[model samples]
Target chain A: MKKLSETKEKRSNLSKRIWADRQLYFMLIPFLLFYVIFVYKPMWGLQVAFKDYNIFKGMSGSPWVGFENFKTIFGNPYFFRILRNTLLISTYSLIFSFPMPIILALLLNEVRIRKFKSLVQTCTYLPYFISTVVVAGMVTSFLAPSTGMVNLILAKLGFEKIYFLSKPEYFRTIFITQGIWQNAGYSSIVYIAALGGIDMELYDAAMVDGCGRWKQTLHVTLPGLLPTIVTLFIISVGNILNVGYEKIILLYQPATYETADVISTYVYRLGVEQANYGVSTAMGLFNSVVGFVFVYAANKISNKINGMGLW
Target chain B: MTMRTRGEKIFGIFNAILLTAIAMVCIYPFIYILAVSLSDAKSVNMGAVWLLPKGINLNSYSQIVHKEGIWTAYLNSFFYMFMGTAVSMALTTLGAYALSKKRLVGHRFLNLFVVFTMWFNAGMIPMYLNFKNMGMLDNRWAIIFGFAINTYNFVILRTYFANVPQALEEAAKIDGASDFKVLLKIYLPLAVPSLATVALFYAVERWNSYFWPMILLKSDSKIPLQVVLKKMVVDMSSRMDSLNYGRDMTGTSEDGFIYSTMVIAMIPMLILYPFIQRYFVKGVMVGSVKG
Candidate 1:
């Protein structure tokens, strides 16, 4: 009977030891508080997707509409167009813009002059801090077509001036170019840091083996940068619907809506401009699902290829 | 080390010219706006302003300072930036610290739940409705409350926590230090670089936020600098006939005032930049790879 009592005491002691450290648990309190109060609490309102949500009616009192909102958004012909634009722009951006910073990082890594490299980096990154309002301003000012400097230069070269912003044909070019200009330098910093972490001993061995700069870069630097690149790629894929509607809203006029209108801008209109909460939430949920699938798939592929995943 | 080859030297020269040209193109608009803002209104109207100003004047800046409601806008922005960034940093650090522990039960679930919110969101109307329900509408906390701690920053903060040597936390543990004590006293002090980077990130994001402010803030007085900038750029084109820059009440053309307002909009960012400029790229890099 005494031995059994001792065993029970020992078992409780073992269970207590296995429990999460109290101090660690204490540190997590504020974290849980924040998410619960803000995030998880707000998540309850997500039920509004199934309800006809009116401000005065409130979430609780709002009548359940079932799949009506989703049906409404899905039934609209404009839905496919916005989805197509979102997918197309994100796909192109991933293909073209994703590789640019990698190339820029490679070029920067090869630059022997530290001053020049830093200067180039600073120059490239300058545009990012320029507000979207200002960037759009610059885009219009630079691509004015008639009196603009770009057109003037093009005219000097004996080519017809292109009304880039006003025309649907030139919309993607302007968007992608501005995006590359704004992001390339800022994006390359991660790759540069990754390159920095490459062990010096590895480089020294490659040198002893008589590998030149190009060979060293291919064999040593590129391999080291792979994980960082994969991570960034996964993140970018995660934001598949993040077409950054602010710039598009500021820049796009009715003439270029065919190319310029994305899921976010559409949401802004259906939500803010038109005041359709249910449709907007449904649309937002749709975008979220697509974005989630991409991130999930991207992580899976990355893990398969290189043993690197978001997890 | 071998010297750059003859072809390499030429390539370097070509790269230098290309980069410089791109830099000038990137940088010159702000300079142009600056010169345009400083130039005499007549010079600006005729597009006479060049790389250098025709005249140097603080008329635009002073006029904005003197305007009836402009000070309110400045105050609104300041209140938002100062309180918003501080709260964000604190919440992010504490939350991230807690989540970074592998031993913490439910860590994986917590992570999945948080990261899920990043991609999926309730759209603007739902969010607005959500805010109104919570009594955040027209409140300064509306902006602050909605995004006090970004998940991306939380991830970076968690990564920094993961990086602290386990043995160090254990030693502190052996000394009978509580979790909060070790986090506040030991971990935070050691993680200055990450903390600074995250703080800068939040500060910049909060400062640059326009859409939320435009949505949640109904009063013009509550609008931030970006909102004002948007008005000057977009609404100004439509409302150009309403403004006159000088005493004649017709003294300056709409173009002159528009350019002046554009330049005025840039001043805050420029002023606030030097303080956090060094950390800007480093912050992005950390948030990108590790986040």
Candidate 2:
């Protein structure tokens, strides 16, 4: 009876606190309402992955198919191909595109000319703002057989013109190179800012120790950037399976699908193009689960190693 | 200041030269595109237009202005950018402000809820289905309200709001100012630069976004500039494809037309590049520090 009264008193205290904060709660109403509709509602709709979702039948009216959709996806041979493609593209991107910004930042940081530095930054950063459509279009035009700049250069060099876009072997290189071109400068902003935060005294001390500029960079600047690099790296690891399909969809053609067809693009083709909602949702759910696992593992490893976590 | 060694001087010169080459490479594609677009069709076809225009003409540009649905697509894009940014800023500000307060009810859970959406989402199929179910397919409101707040921007704004001097809030409370009034009169005024950063982020996203609009909006009348540009530049044949574009500019060539369209689409962004360049570094810094 005494314990029950103590619990009652705590409940009343919480109620009083909530009443005092009613105004703050009122301010959050619209945000919460929209959040539920836009975010949580879709999360709720994940149930369709289990159901044999028919567009006309609606989500609720659709018949439940248990794990049949999941079975179908696993049973299909194409799923494995897409999975392999997804992993390869993301791994290639991680290997090739990840270090570009850091390299650019380090290169830019070594320059003492303010005007030259800003001009380079401005030129490089311009591509990040260009739409994916435009970028993909530019890629196509630049790789065109006869009139394209690349082919023209090849001809001038006395080499036979190659249709770079149609070749499966060339797809990953083109995609990775385009990713670097579009993003390297903009991604360097974080590193540039981090570079700015390093103390002048460290460089001075390094200089006093007879360290040259390169040595000072290797010792002082690199160590200073370690935390930022680690954090960004962990984030990228979590996103290893989440290759964006927008650019891939824009760039890929039938001839190049052998190398270019990732899981997200396959899901896109199934759901939007074919109207196969049930199987597509199951694949999507699978992707999300894998993505969540990657994030959880990355966070766990990060916490164990450095006492830092995404949470 | 100590005098630089010869080695240091040489290294500096090499660095400058390398960086200049990189910058030139970065900007050269756009220059080439512009050159190709302005040159006559024969020169472009013969690969004669390399770094500069030959037989330069404004025919493609003038032709694009008269193209059907181009003006409508531009108007649609502008509308989306303005309305979408406004809604996003409002929602993000309110949500971030309330969540910023440690004393607020369910504060921890609310913050987690916002950030969790970043790590794991329902993916594309469910999202598209949800919009379709809500009769939002082909609707303009779908474009605006569908993606109201980006969580990264929310976190950045919330961090800025949380760092606002609590002493100012205490002073405002003593004046008997309500939470909403205090937010508008105090927090909003103090958070202009941060707000601009987030707003610009939303504006650029809204402008450049084509995926959802391509999927959700079916009607030609409602599609954005990027979609229209994609149709002409990427999918269509670009040789003698100018017959349907305009009558007087019949021989202007579709190759030239595609380049012109790309240039036109890029003009707005290039104009706003300076403004965007100013705030993104600060914005990125805040997020990185908090992380």
Candidate 3:
């Protein structure tokens, strides 16, 4: 008799639990509607890469092109050049820009005074908030190779003024170093947060072992922030193909296109400026695929090594 | 006891100097621009105004304010940011809540679907053409809907919701509260900081956005501030013919006002960032810890 009563009561409770969450479920409806309409439905249009699309005829009426656009992109004379520039610039940025934030965070962590630390942080992040156009414009004006401040200083110091923007050799260096200056401080915030969250007990233990500040930072702080570092690294890999069209467009001209013109800027020129939709779409699709692959590979490796990744 | 010897002392000072120098390198150039913008045109052109304004003035700022499309661009950017943030926040919160529930129907499938898009996009041209077909191309709504649910933000939000103590919901249930009531009464209040952070994240992303806006916002009338900023950077007189964009007081080219326009584009975010800074890092990146 007791068992029977308990079973009946449990069943009633289960039903109540299931039915009680209706409004919560109701709130989720619009988001589901949004994804279905925008993301999912549009995924069907990926077929356009294979089709000879016409603005007037539209997707349904367009003739099947079947790898023609892809073929043309591959056959294009400048495909290799653009691809190389994209890879080189991304690689340069990755090498220089990736590690500066971690190091900045470490340096910031050592400062005992709160006000000074914050001032350092504030000063660093200010550059990031400045518009990319202005950053590029500043870069242009500063690197004018003669009258610009850099050259002015160079001339004072008895060095020849190197034309930073117009020279292909100097373009990647200027882009990467300036990229570091603009973003390293802002990016350090993530690592700083991670560092801040590390258990104080770990540092205490390290100190008990006679570990120096450098040793504690190397052993404790670095490892504690490892997960954040890994995740950000993977996300950045996914973004490698996104070579910031606005700044690049502003910085590049016919003279520097040899090294500076990347896939994003190239697509903007051909697609938006020239209005050739098909080839630019092919180029964009190409960028997405490569980015997707890099992200996937990085995540997989990170998962294998640390059991932490974007996946 | 002597571990912190003379070498250690030197290292510490060296580290401090390097970092402080780096900090100045990051900051001083922009300050130079600010100085130049406020300086008299003669001093600015001659590079005398690198650190300080030659003649203190507010003319440059007023000149940009008086530009034709500048105000419209500001309004357009706000419309996209405000409306876009509202829709994005609503969807992300609800989607997160739904998925956070362990007993919810089809939760696994939904999670998988969201994550799949993160790894593989449907590519840009398709996204653009799709927006075109849905009568949304060239629409701010198109921009709004294009990035409605970022998987990263979705996961962060879910982490926040999932961390909400289950007992709170259970007690609310015992009180005859619906799931909606529990979410509203309990979760929303607790999740305010996270919501503010993520909302700021969405706002920043929407504000800083340019590429898709470049594709979708074909209409000149609907251009966002970032797009206009881009045009100005590319060409000084992109929106203004050089004739029309001249300085108000001195009657020279609007070089004085260029920095002013860029500054105007930046002000809204700057004003909004500090208020949310307290919660920004923790609230948003808490989702990152789920990895």
Write down the lDDT of every candidate, Cα atoms only: 0.74, 0.87, 0.76
Please list the Cα RMSD from the true structure of every candidate, rounded to 1 decimal place: 4.3, 3.2, 4.8
lDDT of 1 at A49: 78
Candidate 1 lDDT over A1-311, as tens digits, reads: 99999999998876685464676666566666666666666667778778898878878888999999999998999888888888888888999999988988887777778898887777777667666776776676556544344765677799986666667878777888888888887777878888888998898899889876668888998889888787778868877877878878877767788988899899888887788888887787778677778778887787787776666
How much lDDT does candidate 1 score?
0.74
Per-residue lDDT of candidate 1, residues B15-134 (tens digit):
677666766766777787777667777665444566888867767767777775666776776778788989888778877887788877677887787777665555555667777777
| TM-score between model 3 and native | 0.88
TM-score of each: 0.87, 0.95, 0.88
Interface RMSD of 3: 4.9
Order of models, best TM-score first: 2, 3, 1
Q: Write the per-residue lDDT of candidate 2 for residues B78-106, one digit (tens) a residue.
A: 99999999999999999899999998768
- What fraction of the native interface does candidate 2 get right in terms of contacts? 0.63
Candidate whose lDDT is highest: 2
**TM-scores of chain B, in order:** 0.89, 0.93, 0.89
Q: Is 2 or 3 the stronger prediction by DockQ?
A: 2
The deviation in Å at residue B237 for candidate 2 is 6.9
